[model samples]
Target chain A: MKILVCISKTPDTTAKISFTDNDTKFNESGVQFIINPYDEWYALVRAIELKEKDPSTIIHLVHVGPAENDAIIRKALALGGDEAFRINSHPGDDYYVAGQIVNLAKEQHYDLIFTGKETIDYNGSSVGGMIAEFLELPYISLATKFELNGNTATITREIEGGEEVDEAALPIVVSCQKGMAEQRIPNMRGIMSARTKPLKAIEPVAIDPLTSISSFELPAPKQGVKMIPADNPEELVRLLHEEAKVF
Target chain B: MSVLVFLDQAEGHVKKSSFEAASFAAKIAEQTGTEANGIVLGEVKDDLQSLGKYGIKKIYHAADAQLNQFDDEIYTALIADTVKSSGSNVVVLSNNFNGKAIAPRLSVRLKSGLISGAVGLPDTSNGFKVKKSVFSGKAFANVEIKTDIKIITLNANAFKVTEGSGTATIENITTQIPRRKVNVREVNVVKGEVPLAEAELVVSGGRGLKGPENWGIVTDLAKALGAATACSRPVSDSGWRPHHEHVGQTGLTIAPNMYFAIGISGAIQHLAGVNRSKTIVVINKDPEAPFFKAADYGIVGDAFEVVPKITEAVKKLKGQK
Candidate 1:
């Protein structure tokens, strides 16, 4: 089985998000970039699990970014991926990113493609589905548990209210969420082997971006906390009804 | 110039978010001097004509059994083909799982500008600016769509469902159904009084509930109020509740009208998921819990005592109403 895992290099969760150059681009000054936690913890881990279960399975990591993202690609290799490919271009928008991924996946004819539900920075959650459509394949999002038998793969996802079970074929895309697997740190031996793994960089096919980010800004700070007497439940109700009008 | 709305349904029923999407599209149609039409992929048990109450002039049904289950590839292609046939300049969908999957796909196929998680109508007076949440509900961003075909996926429960009376015409459309490579073998449904995502009111508990044995109080209150049940990530990880019911940044994001959090400390991740709730009520024995800072109503009392009393009050009030 050929498994393709899409990874994105994003600022660490604690990094302060800011913009530079008249608010047109993300400012990366003094910010540390890491493989998106969701991709590393869930999607990549699960793909490695499948590879472990079957040695014949191959796990390849793909990213849409510039050469600066190679270190993160090497980290993913250190974690578990057998090989890595970096598309030599910054993803201008969600459409361009999805198009690049779809083009690559189609060229490779991967049996299964895995991605996190959404990237931490963009939080778009649209690339996996877009690729699925471009390839004319089934897609399951936010899958917590997945099982494969022959050509069919059964996935369990949490819907708005309850749990729903769905099945798809081998040539499908799945966006993984939590509970798929526990996060793993690379061991010494694994890190040593990752240094020898092949990390290839390839140029992205030309594609026009349909969208652009005009600006970026931080959210307003929350209002100061208001404390109420602990013993007075009626006061709380009154505040809700009269002041907040939310009841 | 008609507005086409994708009405997502599951198991022969329309989803709650679909109604919100329909109403949103109808408002847009009214603004643009066009009529609103809905497209359904599979068989639905509800009366298609009754959807006219939301200002839909007609409903298009592609009644293929294969579409009864969600197949993104087929759904995207069908929607793209429908837009072309109907000549719809504007497309609307609910920013739920189905919409999230198909919207971007449609955008790429149609070469249209797409905005997901829209909270309000676009500012048509200006080019085409749609307001959407950014940074995990921390802020808002106004995005402009430059393309002729504009697609907006409204957030679930963001728009109100308007009630009115009208008889919509139901038309059966014929289209070639794309072959799906995926196959569904079995479905495992979780049985409970309320579904977490669709519930207007939710009652959630955390590790402060002590143990799984004491969970009856939370469940009883949820039953009395006809609300969905949820747990903080800690509770779910501790095996007190299924992971599906976990609500947080790393978990499920929900926007119910009323959210009752009991014995839970509001972590930033948890707050990210539920901050969009219209009203938040927190009940905890600790007076200094962070949840109280964000709660519209806070009861600093023991859940063991406060939950039962609240349940009794809800039962009594519901009987009266």
Candidate 2:
């Protein structure tokens, strides 16, 4: 089975989110970039789990970014992907990114594609579904559990009020959420093997972007906390009713 | 010109977020000098004409029994066809799971530009630009959509639903419902009082609550306030709470109107998922807990002492005492 896992490089969760260049672009200065936690923890881990179960299964980590993202791609390779592909272009929009992934998925004829429900950077949660649409394949989003037998794959997706279990054929896309798997760090041997792993960087095919970022700004700072005396529950109720008007 | 809004429904009732989207689309239609229309693709039990209160002039129903359930491919194709048939240049959807799944697919099929998680109306004076949250609610970005067909998926709680004094004309649209290759086997619902994501209020606890046995205070408060229950990632990791109840960067993102954080330290990842709440109240023994910084109200006390008192107060206030 050929499985493609799409990963994105994003600022660490702890890093204070800020933008540079007069707030037009994200501030990369003094920021540590890692493979998006969702992609790394859930998508990649699940893909590796499949690879471990079947040695014949190949896990390919696909990324859409410039050369600066290679180190993270190598880190993903270190984790468990058998090979990697770095599309040498800045993903302009969700559609462009999906187009690139669809191009690769078509060329490789991957049986299954895995991705995080959304990238921490964009938070669009649109790429995986868009790729599935572009490839004309079934897509299951926010999947927590996945089982593949024969040519059919059964997936459990977390919906609004409950869990929905659905079955799709091979050549489908599944966007994994947090409950899919626990986070895994690359071991010493796995890190060493990653150096020898084949990582091919390819230029992206021509694609048009339908949207552009007009501007960006940081969220307003939260107001100072209004303390209610711990012993006085009535005061808390008063604040809820009069001040916050939440109740 | 006509504006089309997707009315997402489940089990025969319209979703709350869909009402907001309907209201927003109606306002957009007013701005663009057109009539707002709605498309519901399922078996609806509600009176379709009553939806006109949101300012929609017409309601399009594709009431195939198979459409009662959500199938993304079939729904997307159906919506794309609806847009073409209605000559709708602007499309609106609730930014819920269903809308998120199908909006992008419709965008690709129609060659349109989409802005998901739209928080406000587009700034149409200069160009078609919509404001949306970025960096997991840590920032905002205005994205310009320069396409013939424009799509906006409004965030669940971002817009307020408006009521207009009129009735919408119901129209049945005929179209081929694409066959979904996938089959839904079963639905495993989390038996709870409140729907977490759509809940107006949420009561969440963390490791400070001690263990799963001590979770009653959280549940009691949530029940008293008619709010959903949630827990920090650590609580879910420790098996004190189900993973579905975990609210954090890696967990479910929610934007309830009011959020109550009990014994939570306000980790950045957890804050990322819930910072969008209109008002936040924090209760913790540590006065310097980071959560207080982002909280609108705080009580410096132990969870054991604080939660029960608040729950009692709510019960009394609601005349349930």
Candidate 3:
């Protein structure tokens, strides 16, 4: 089975977020980039775990970005991906990005595709469903647990106030979340092996962005805390009611 | 020609976030000189006509028993058909679990432009533009949608719901259930618990709480404030709490009226999920904790002592009310 996992390059979790050009663009200077945890920890790890169980399974990591994202993709390759591909394109809106991925995946015709439930930077959980819709396949979002037996797969996802277990055949798409798989660290041997793996770059198809960003504004700074005496917890409640009116 | 809202419901009751979505759609419709209608896919027991208080002129309910449980493919297909028949060019939904699962698929089915996580209404003076939070609540982006058909999902609690003096007409629409490629075997529902998605207030703890045995401190505060309970990623990772209760970038992203974070050190991932909250209160023993910088309120103290005292104070206040 050939499985494809889509990866995204995002700023490290601890990186300080700042904008440039009058808040019209993200500042990339002095920022560290890493593989998006959702893709690295859950989606990619789960795909590698599936490949480990079945020798015939080949895992391919796909990223849609410029050349700067190659390093991040290589890190995913070191983690256990058999090969990697970079769709040479700019990361535009979700629709444009999904269209690029769909065009590529349609040609490969992989049995299963996996993606992070949402990118940490964008926090827009729309790509997986859009890919599924464009491809006309079954898509499952926010799957926490997945098990495969033969060609059928059983997956569990959290709903509004409950958990749901669903079964689907092969050739499906799943957006993985936490609990799907544990984070994997690359060992010395895996790092050495990754150097010999093939990394291919494919040109992206031209697609117009349906949405354009006009500007970006940072969140308002928080106000100073209201200090109440440790001995006067009742005053905190009073402040919450009379001053804040929250409770 | 009109705006259509997708009212998400669970157990026959309308979700609070859906009310926000309805009001958002109504406001947009008013701006465009159009009527606002709603479509619900479930066996809802709530009074459908009463939804008119949110400015909905009519409500179309697809009372299919199978829809009681959400199936995104089925919902996408049915809602797409409904949108076509209803002649609604604009669609609105709350960016909750159900809306997140279905909006993108529906957008593709209808070949419409979609803007998820919308924070502000459209600026229609020069075409259609909407504001949304990007970079995980660190920044906002104003996007212009050019497609003839537009689907928008409002972020939870981003808009205020207002009531109007009107009544809505209810209509029942029949839709064919799509072939089930994915079969739902069982549903384990969490009962008697406030769902974190729409909770106005949240009280969360982290590994600093020591262990699961001491979880009462967190729950007590949540109960007193009538809020939901959540946990940091480390708390859930170590099996101290269920995965569903995990609140972070990798877990659940929530925007509540008030977020009371106790014992958490304010990691960026954790902040990404709850930073959109209107107000944040951080309590920890370390005065140098990063959370204090972003919190509207800060307290430096031991959890064991400070939590119980706060809980008692809340109880006392509620008793007076």
Q: Which candidate is the best by DockQ?
A: 2
User: What pairs collide in candidate 2?
Assistant: none
Better of 1 and 2 by TM-score: 2
Give all candidates' CA lDDT scores: 0.82, 0.89, 0.88
Interface RMSD of 2: 1.1
Q: Rank the candidates by lDDT, best first.
A: 2, 3, 1
B267 Cα displacement, candidate 2 (Å): 1.5
Instruction: Give the Cα error of residue B179 in candidate 3, in Å.
Output: 0.9
Off by over 4 Å in 1: A14-32, A216-247
Runs in model 2 lying further than 4 Å from the true structure: none
lDDT of 2 at A9: 90
**Where does candidate 3 clash, by residue pair?**
none
Chain A TM-score (model 2): 0.97
TM-score for the first chain in candidate 1 comes to 0.96
Share of reference contacts found in each model: 0.36, 0.76, 0.72
Give the CA lDDT, 0 to 100, for residue A144 in model 1: 87
Clashes of each: 2, 0, 0
Candidate 3 lDDT over A133-234, as tens digits, reads 899888888999999999999999878777889999988999999889999899998888888899899999988777777777777777777766666677
| Ten residues in sequence with the least summed lDDT for candidate 2 chain A | A217-226
Query: Model 1, B1-321: lDDT tens per residue?
Result: 899999999888888889999999999999989999999999889998999999999998998887898777788889999899999999999888778878988998898878888878988896887877655654456677888999989986789998679778998988889787656555566666676765788899998999989999999888877788999989998889988788876677777888889899997778767878887888888888988888777777888977776776666645733
All candidates in order of TM-score, best leading: 2, 3, 1
